[model samples]
Target: MASNGMESMQLAEDQIKILEENFNRVSKHPDESTLMLIAAESGLTEEETAKWFRLRNAQWRQAEGLPAQLGSVKD
Candidate 1:
């Protein structure tokens, strides 16, 4: 029930395809330049692309029985 917005975001078929393509190409953390390029090509903001990758990676890690923070660096 947290309200961070975009919870109701419904991507169009084209947008979904674009995102899916990018996701498959870079399931792990993508660099800022690549992400920005993807965002521009997919008509999404960099933040949205980053969030999508984060959530997708979390799901992937969960399925693989790995910690969600596996590749993340801790301070």
Candidate 2:
């Protein structure tokens, strides 16, 4: 059960990377009009888009590597 949750989290992280790249490409002005639109089109809320990118940017700090960053910390 716990492992399933972990897998889902990792998939989320991978998705974050893709979105981060997309955001960077479009957000060169940092205030581009499409920021909201892109986030919405990606099926993520404005808040969730911001949150996931934060995690994606921090991927380098993850010791287990990107795919294993959210592994069962308890198990």
Candidate 3:
């Protein structure tokens, strides 16, 4: 579990690039184990990785003119 304030920390450029590459290869919402591996590689907590995915997915959906509820794990 992560501390509340930990969510505000920014990832380094390399970490963001790595994450972006993986995101492009994978679905917007990756499975838990894959997410954990990504978190480890990106030097982010699982919470931050999840949050980033959530936000990025929302942005992607908006750009595609899709509803936010579509193609989400929560659906």
Candidate 4:
């Protein structure tokens, strides 16, 4: 569990590598089918994969001096 009382999910190093490679080389806003494939490749659920992409995109936007909430994942 996390400090916030929610279950904490930690990705293994290999999983992180997989996700990072995809994020760098592929579309940031992946479609549903792509999300399914990524989830399978990373050994995560579709929901988890989508959440990871959402958080990663926000971080990327923030790093680029853009608002974290500037756009939706569907954008």
Top candidate when judged by lDDT against the true structure? 4
Flag regions of model 3 displaced more than 4 Å.
1-9, 71-75
Best first by lDDT, ranked? 4, 3, 1, 2
* Model 1 residue 46 distance off true place after TM-score fit, in angstroms: 0.5
TM-score of each: 0.72, 0.42, 0.76, 0.82
Candidate 1 residue 2 C-alpha distance from true site, Å: 11
| Clash-forming residue pairs, model 2 | none
Instruction: Please provide, for model 2 over 1-75, each residue's C-alpha lDDT reduced to its tens digit, 9 standing for 90 to 100.
Output: 233222244436555565766756755222334556656666667655555544543443353355634444421
Instruction: Give the 10-residue window scoring lowest on summed lDDT in candidate 1.
Output: 1-10
What TM-score does candidate 2 get on C-alpha atoms? 0.42
- Provide the lowest-lDDT 10-residue window in model 3: 1-10
Point out where model 2 deviates above 4 Å.
Answer: 1-24, 27-34, 60-75
lDDT of 3 by residue, 14-53 (tens): 9888788888997677999999999999988998888888
Q: Which is the better candidate, 2 or 3, if ranked by lDDT?
A: 3
Task: Give model 4's TM-score versus the native structure.
Answer: 0.82
Instruction: Give the alpha carbon lDDT tens digit for every residue of 1-75 in model 1.
Output: 354333455667787688778878764778999899888988889988777777667667768998866765631
lDDT of 1: 0.73
The superposed Cα distance between candidate 4 and the true structure at residue 1, in angstroms, equals 21
**TM-score of decoy 1:** 0.72
